[model samples]
Target: MAYNVLSVIPARKGSKGIPRKNLRQLGEDPLVAHAIKKSKKSNWIDHVALTTDSQEIAQIGRQYGVDTIIDRPTRLATDEIPLAPVIEHAFEEVDHEFHYVLCFQPTAPLVSVDSIDEGIEAGIDSNADSVVFVRDSTHIYWRDGENGYEPVASDRKNRQQMDEIYQEIGIFLSENHIVRQGRRVGDSSEFYEVGMYEGIDIDTYADWILAESQLQRKQVLYRLIGNGNAGTGHVYRGITIADRLFEHDVLFAVEATEDLAIEKLEESNYDYQIFENEPSFLDYVRSTQPDVVANDILDTSAEYIKSLKEYTSRVVNFEDLGAGTDHADAVINALYEHSNPPENHYFGFKYFCLRNEFRYADPRTAIPSVERIMISFGGTDENNLTAKTLRALSDLDHELHLDVVLGLGYTDQGSLDSVTATYPPNISVEINQNVQSMAEHMEQADLLITSNGRTLYEAGSLNVPVISIAQNHREQKHPYAHISRGVLFLGQAEYVTEENVRTAVEEYVTEREKRETMREALEGHDITNGVERIKQIMFNQNNAD
Candidate 1:
């Protein structure tokens, strides 16, 4: 427990999504600022440091008092560079002994300070090789091509029969878990279930849009995506999709911004460009013009894209920029589209759904349990619902676990803190950001009291009985869509009242048979193997020619 924890934030100059992503602003601060700030604030973290080759990113780290900047070499910054080696190289540079090495990406701007503390505590208390923070995604899977996505018996077996499945939410806590460490899967690593947003990363422009839009909840750029805030969502979503797609080289076109989201991208060290004007954007494309340019149009002007499309063979308008039906050859939707289609058409959620390869827990083993009420309203929740929901949950008569998700871009952490301090004995508050599989956590819960958005879809997919809360004007419009389809929507006709929220939970909780029915409906959702499906689409398209 008394060991030094070295926090390394890897950032490189070369990027494709938005130029200088690491140094880029996510709301008012840079992307790396979130992780660096969170690391600095964490009670368990001894020292917050950074690993980067970019002087700008290093300077920003310095601005935040993050002095440990490990200069990553060009060799390790390559597109083919595996993260393990990059992390190993940095740890090798450290001369002192450390208890835990927490590696976080600036992209995951919404990482919760409490979750970091929890992971560190778990790592020490469990006496495990590594206590990595992860969110369990039960509905997610990948096909081996044989099972065809049929639910694995291990997944469908009784709750007692299932094994917990965890993914390395880019944010990792390494406790000397390598080959030399001695133990399978990196020194008997244990998984910590953080909130859903923490699992987000930027892999493709579409994924980037999904992460940002989901958190902002307002149409900033496109109806699907939103203002550039946290870089983690963009980074995680992009990586997930790129990992799925086989042959396409994902390029990110980011405009210059003063937000932390951009810095996170720079830290990612992907092939990217920073555009200041239309001419520069066009020049960027013509210079290293990739086969396809996945535009992360956070603030990118239309003229730039219009011109680039003329010169480039294919410009896939990732739905990052407000509806681009008029601009590109193809549009990538992480939630709606699954497979590649003919020209003039695009893909969405279907493409990004969970793959079968990730199904670690059998459904049979999954117990019919509901304990916590998950409240996730992206970073910078334009609507301050975190405190409101906590107040409502505190009023509930039955024991309820309050799972609260905080975003780096969230401006109301102070308010959230105030709520946590006043919470009743039955209410438990968890401040989290980037987590692994969010679906698995949803699966464990009985009633989900959240806004009608991405998390709702995730809950629906997992058969987690949901009580949708309309936190904002946009949410108010269709609070009951999920409920009409069998998921409960709570805020229609008025902002979700505390009494109404409690009533909805009671209604869902008391009826065991109704909960079972909801679970069955969740079973019908097409299994999402976002990774494998993307792999098939990209590989097939890449090999088609």
Candidate 2:
């Protein structure tokens, strides 16, 4: 059977702490609207009514589709009047009878609808006379006496050893018959404990400011540690994920020597800070205390991960395959794979993080002949693979256009400039730096010669056939750069000769059937929705805690 429940929201114009507090805007809506909306959304609430002496408050309640409005008299609306008489007046004003009454205050706008419904269900299930919402309080007790100050309880005991104390948070539910007998709570009453953020009451100006700030977007910190040795894959990956998080206040944190990473952060116009060591970084983390810390520092140590856990609530690691994986809350390694990965670890091509531009671009169609070839080796090509690939392409007899994409950290610009100037009439060299339209370059090219990093996934998304060269030992073990996936993996850059690169380019240029087969294989993998999948994991981890 369904129980008839009535929810009442009382708003008065005589608030001494803050004038017109109920009608003032908190976030997007007034303070009183939150209470009315929560009551209307409750499944156990049969009807909702507003009791107020001010016409302005009554009009606002009508806009929220309240069932009825009880116009309180001047005598009963005074400061000395108790809540029991006001609830009794509202009960007599309504036309229909109710079995239970819920007294919700407009000041406590953080109370959830589920809590209200749960309180009603608890009162009906146990056949109790009253139900109240409470929150745990941890404070030292003290009292004033005729002599001086005295301790109310034992002051020697610690907080954990002390008994748990709960304080009522302005919400009261009682049987209608008991409320009519001039009692807010009867002898039999139960309590429902709520979280800290949910039981906040907006009585003072400071309290209102605190509630409004929480309703805004959450703060997120991206701790990206990328350099010449570690490569710039983590830097680019961190920026891509931060751009997609539009609902958060994203900031970048890097080391003092990571000039390339700092340049990219400034180019993207993001807020950032530079630290000297791990201890300084931990100090910054403790000072800010963000809701989540996105660590893109490659492999992390167990001690470093544990130190981060002390400052932040959640730690999300990207491309991590070290002892820290055992302690991290969530780990995402898209390039490498493990035989027995952890439960929170996400590996393989399914979680590849691509930029927004490449994910939304249309797939390119294969042409009959190879005309243009593109070369890109991440943001900081520490191995100087661009010069090596350009020299090999210059030795080719086939007349083709070369688009050499230089990174911001490329230091050997004079050597590349000399090679471009000494090119033959049949061969042309076009150097592009910090290009935003990388997908456009990939789409216009017949093939791409790059490293086994984020560019490999971007090229695959456009269905551009690639010839991947490992810049270091780490990229050699990357599973995504394989012949089955339309990529011709040419071992490492240090071992690959000029003749080997030229021979491989000639084979793909002459055989049209081989190029089409590679393009077809590249289209088989779905990498467009990897960002969404990773976001769901982070959000699930946040809600679980």
Candidate 3:
């Protein structure tokens, strides 16, 4: 059953904080109009009206077409008087038989219909004296002591370990009796935490500036897809882009089946949602109405891109080869090459988005001989090339150190461990996962053996000599791994024999000048500034629209 709710937006115009604040513009609407329009959209909120002392405020209220406007006395309108008496007078003036009353401050323009509904729903379900809308605070509480300010807690603790403290945003839904009694809340209350940004109240100029800044940034939804089979490169790529877009409101949407993506996202500490299928995902897109949809899933279908365009302002697909390139605003592929591509399609190394650590990585332009060998087949190593390549090298007579880097999603850790134990004491093996800094390892290595993917671009940036083996046919098509670009392009893993890998490893190990030449050739390709370039492309397309 729906609750009968009355929303009263209070806006007293003559202000000490900021003059004409209620009438002042916030984004496109006046401050008071935000609550009024948002309240009207609530499915559970029955009626929404304005109660203000200023005639200008009332005129703005009527301009927005509120259901009712209650005039407040000059005495109750003063800054000295609290909101309780003003709300108390307005409740008496309205004369409506409502199940509950909601007081939304005009200063809080960030409030949404969803937040209001959540508060009301909590009030009804819990049947508390009031429902207090609050936000989670991590800051340590302090109070003015006899001599100086003192900590509110008995002991200091980390933010994660400490119990969450709910600080009210001065927005609440209370029982009818409490409103009549000139009280905003009672003894019993349910604490409902609003979104971090939505609870922002514009009290002072600093808060007003912050609210305005938040309004200016776009709401971006990153549609990331990954799994044990697909590999976590796409997920990491999406996270890199999301991390770069710290200015915007970035939210990730991944499939429910992509547990690897979920685990990685959790470790990255970002906000995300899980959907079962395409229909539910599109429903989320409609509800979110994201300004831009950035898809990091390698290829996107024309039908999928078309569906996303309906709900978003701009549709951007990364590493896309599907027919969707023609329909999408921008299709940026950092690896593949196309002879006759769609007008919207952009293919090449310039669009590659590198991880943050690579930005500071120095190129090992000169290496005397191959001492440290780095082997990585991406996160999943879906092809099981790491073990095959490791086994292929076990017969090597050369004295060298092998550094095996596997993905977190790698299923056969046991196989890699067993192979590591078999290596001679002179030829050591070090296996690493969830590497804090990929470039650090790349910087120290004389030669790197990796799959033909985004990792190739990372190696290219640091002039790390690479032996590329294609993970699949799709990866074989990537032109960046070719001999011309400083990498020895071995055919797909299945076609390449264990002898073929060992032969190549022996050649690089034995030939000192060959590895040096490849390392120097890598310096010609400029791939470090890709993340910035990609950001420009996404924003340029958005600006064009």
Candidate 4:
């Protein structure tokens, strides 16, 4: 049996909490317009009837393309008058007969079209006289003065374990006859559960503000400070995470010295601003007033984090171990692993933000012998480790190909040029190559020589046996690059001589068993899901307050 559903949007001019609340602008449209749009888009709604006392509201309803405009009398528009009379007045105005009346309050703009259709279907299927839109209010309860505070139900179970308690979210579906009698529900009534986000009801000024904020997209400021001294790992990590958060408006904030970081942001077509100093950066952040600030500048100072917290509601730091980490709402240290980190600090390989190319690429199968070797030491080899590794590989007596991957920030082109000129027929260098091809190179190569940085995790995901050389003492502490994880961590680059690289390369090349074992061990780690895990943590932290 088909039911003719009449969607009634009641918008009164007078509001005690917020004057003209229904007509007030919410984002691009007015509060009442939201309900009008939802009703018009609904598949179950046969006709939309907007009830209002004010002529201005009637004009607005006509502009919104409502089929019937019910001019509610001043007597029935009083605050003391209930919603049932106003709905009944609307039913008397419309010519077409409707089986059910969907009372969609203008104050509850968050109501979705799907919920309207679903509620109607549920009410029809259950053969109920009325249906109401509800949200799970399991833990919430009222208290009596004499009895003090007590659980609403006898069973004081966990919120998830407790029986679902739903509260009406201002959307009511009632039989046309019951509504005509000034009653929202008869004896039989059912309910449709809408998501918490969609069940938001706007009544007061605070509620309107909250509803408006929910409707608008959040501004996510990514503070990524990377330079020649500090490799481009932070920049890449910031971009990777920002790319995943398509729902939010992402903006990159970098230092002037971070040219490579700026270039990457530009290449990705992301909005960004370069700050000359800390003061300027802080000023910019203050001016923007971002909802959330994701700091990817390694260690953050207490004062810096405090200043950021002053403007932004949520502050997230990436790979931060400084005094500021304690102040940040969430800290993600994916490169370094700590035995017992703070509750906010999410450490280890589980939070490693891998690039889409590496995360989606299939892990390379271990070959019988090391035929082709790939060398990658992050975006900026500040220590000139690339040349050092190249020099070391020059001494290799074995007849095997060496593919040298140069970073964008690798300034010492003279050293690289000299190495290429003198490079034996076996060695070849590819400078400033596309990052997307990095995964392909990792797949083709039998062995990888890289710094103990972000690339280590990427290589591990690819199941490539790696000889990790630490750029500094900090990189050496990375647990993922440890020997236990199958990475032959050749100490700091400053101490690593040409002989050390030659010897390590030769050992890995000759020893097939060791390479295969290392490949198996690296593949055991779940690094592909790190982006999603970190996203969840950030989302939780953003909503923690």
Candidate 5:
């Protein structure tokens, strides 16, 4: 039987130079991501394996489609250790027979697919016992005999006469025979020269800075795909929850077209797969098979839902309407329906309920002293009016802090970014705070300057007086009425002027007794924790089923 080619990436935890350098974000990806990506792209190698002493690196390697991971002993990861011993150690643990193996370093963040292919091909094609990648060095030279200061070359300008200089960059490929023979590289060896940039290794601060500069300054990058939209609110809410539950690097499979929701997702810079139509949706889901899927759609088919259930154990649904139509493993909804209710329905808190689930802090002293007020309209702005409200509040008399939140559904991020750049500095502004820790940020606010959306319920639940900007007709009728009763809703088009915003801030500042009155009305009203309770219910039901 022909032996399969195996790739090994050894990543150790302890480092003397940079702390946790493997996980550091370089440009759009982490340092190790470059090596992992190159390994996956190689056609010659059968399996891309990672041998790591760190659990965190293993988790990260798994995300990028590593076939098998070998946990190395602490002894092998030390700085004094040799690569040959570690490589031999991995062979003992895996107990797999292979024709050839490639040793990859996790520190190189710019390895190319061709470089991997070249090393593997050289090993197989040249009938060589071992192959290693080396690069030409322009920076290093040795003095002639007695350490003379003259140029190393007899004729400095002679292009062809200069001796070619090359150095091994530690990326090597060898057959099992070479290692079993107890030799680092066998007698028959081949050297494959790669580019200078691709040969860079990240070990010290200098190496890290150079790699980061290369990544960040590189022009012509792949166009990023946006997170899909069920609605602007739905996308941000889902991302908020997903970010908290999993690491920030987790990807979500969303059922959305290339709409505003997806665009917003793109702007927020998340790895996502979008299903354009029903048939495409199935193909996309089967191919990607994400760890967890956050479904914002109301109309997931029974066949698709069942297929998803079979494929993965974790499927969380965030539905605005028609939640129980096909029955997801877990469903988060604002209201329950009799005909099609989810098996484990989450229905205690509204989507925009203020995130005031504070247990460690006092409310009275905490509330009034909050210098900043953040006004956000969920993921999609439905109406792009939150920016206007921030502009209006800029004219307030007492030099109050103002923050405006942008949704993923906003028409353009460039316009918003530009507007935010020009907005007065005394007023702080934030975009797409998502839904996760937004409540924590909101809990510290003296007041909420917001639109009459689900966030109003969030503020009302906390009894935070709102200078409501009613951006839509529906919101004007629904949540704007609270603004009149001190929950303060300004009409979508009418009350959002600079003068009105100043008046609202003045009233709230002057009336200290009103703060107490509102607090009493809102006490014991928040119930966002029901999401957790529903999660438990779904988990138990899944086990039962």
Candidate 6:
């Protein structure tokens, strides 16, 4: 059996906070037009009605093809009046026998028609008196008392450990007969839950600003890979970009074997999924219909980029040296620059997206004596560069401190301990593994021995000179770590022996003028604001399209 549902949008002309708010422009349509158009688009709503005391709102409704324009009295439009009487008046004036009445507010432009239809279905299938929308509230409560304000509960807990509290949002549904009794909620009620950002209601200027931002938001997908061999730079880069795009919808997709990537995202607030192959990932992308797809998997095939372009308007890639770079809308390679490159390529250290810690890092003045040196390869240093560098630096025969930073995915954490046992008592070794404080160690170190990957740029952001080595032939192709960027690049992993690393460290330590020159070179280039640069490139092109 089909049930007849009437959706009512009650928009008063005058608002206490924002004048003429209902008739104000939101995107291409006025605020009141959103509810009317949504009601007409719904699968369950049978009729759409608009009730307002202002003729401006009525005219706006007529333009959106509302079924009826009911005149609401001025008395019922005041701030103190309850919504039930206005809904009742609308139900009576529509003249059609509607089995249900839906109350949708103009302030809630982010609520989708699908949520509305589900609320109606939930109300009718259960034969409930009313249905309301709610979201989880994490706020702690304190009540006023004779002495002062006191905790509502005797027990205190962190927000993450607090009991769940649900607060009502902007949509309501009720049976027509129940609404006619001048009541919105009766003995029976059902709750429909909405997401935190989706339940945004516009009342004050701050809320209006948030609603406008949400309205312009887009959905993005980050496809990348991470492992013991390839390192976790891609996953960390994706997290950096996603954090900047908080207003937009961002998701991370990795393979089932990417346990390192999974562990990293698990510690974050963002959500992710595991895919079996390209076809399954594309199917998920097709279903979600994201506005853009960002490929950070190092190198991509032409067919894969084409497949992504089939669903989204823009496809952006990172550090791509493959043929798929031609098909992408944009390619950002912060470590390498291309000669005779395509018009879409953005290369150089100016596009480096620093981690959150390095963005606000303290300015460094150098220790002058080069007492501390940081040795970090990456998350999973397959080459055991930290051990090699530590062993080589132990031959310095001076009082030196070595800070070895290991990521969550380092497979050779134990091998470093074996190497440190062989170190001289004057050369102390401390390994900081699976820790989030990498920037603090880097700040204290006078120099760093890192791979020719993303870590070198992080060193440059803090003006830390580096002795760079390539873990593989592909990383050897990274061009930004040469003498111009405060880094001295050694050959690939198989060729860079202990003698080469020890000699390079001795030069930076004994020669203060060389370290000062490297610091001046790092200061000549800007590399911290690359997140905002990439964000503008992704969002501005989508908006133009």
lDDT of 6 at 207: 82
Looking at model 5, residue 228 earns an lDDT score of 24
Q: Cα lDDT for residue 195, model 5? A: 84
Candidate 6 regions exceeding 4 Å error are 1-3, 78-81, 136-138, 142-170, 379-394, 406-426, 483-485, 541-545
**Candidate 5's error at 292, in angstroms?**
1.8
Ranking by lDDT: 6, 3, 2, 4, 5, 1
Best-to-worst order by TM-score is 6, 3, 2, 4, 1, 5
- Displacement of the residue 252 alpha carbon in candidate 4, Å: 1.7
The whole-model lDDT of each prediction reads 0.60, 0.83, 0.84, 0.82, 0.62, 0.84
| TM-scores for all predictions | 0.49, 0.63, 0.77, 0.63, 0.45, 0.89
Residue 249 displacement in candidate 4 (angstroms): 2.1
Best candidate per lDDT, number? 6
In candidate 1, position 230 carries an lDDT of 34
Residue 486 of candidate 4: its Cα lDDT? 69
**Predicted model with the maximum TM-score:** 6
| Tens digit per residue, CA lDDT, model 3, 394-430 | 9798778888888777878998888878888778888
lDDT of 1 at 284: 62
Candidate 6 has its poorest 10 consecutive residues by lDDT at: 536-545
What RMSD does each model have against the real structure? 23.4, 16.9, 5.1, 17.5, 13.3, 3.3
Error of 5 at 289 (Å): 2.1
The candidate 2 region of ten consecutive residues with least summed lDDT is 536-545
Count clashing residue pairs per candidate: 101, 0, 0, 0, 12, 0
Better of 1 and 2 by lDDT: 2
- Per residue, candidate 6 scores C-alpha lDDT tens digits across 1-545 of 35489898989987999889998888788988888888999999988999999998999888899989999998999999988899999999987888888888888887888988888898889988899887778768999999999988778899888888877776789887789899887679998888887787889888888888888888899988887766678888899999888789898999988877887888886789899988999999888879989988888889988988888988989988898998999998888866665787888787788889888777476547888888888767778888888778866877888888886668776777777887888788888877677788888888989988888888888888888999888888888876465888878999999999999888888998998888778877688888877887676553211
Candidate 1 vs candidate 3: the TM-score winner is 3
lDDT of model 5, residue 36 = 80
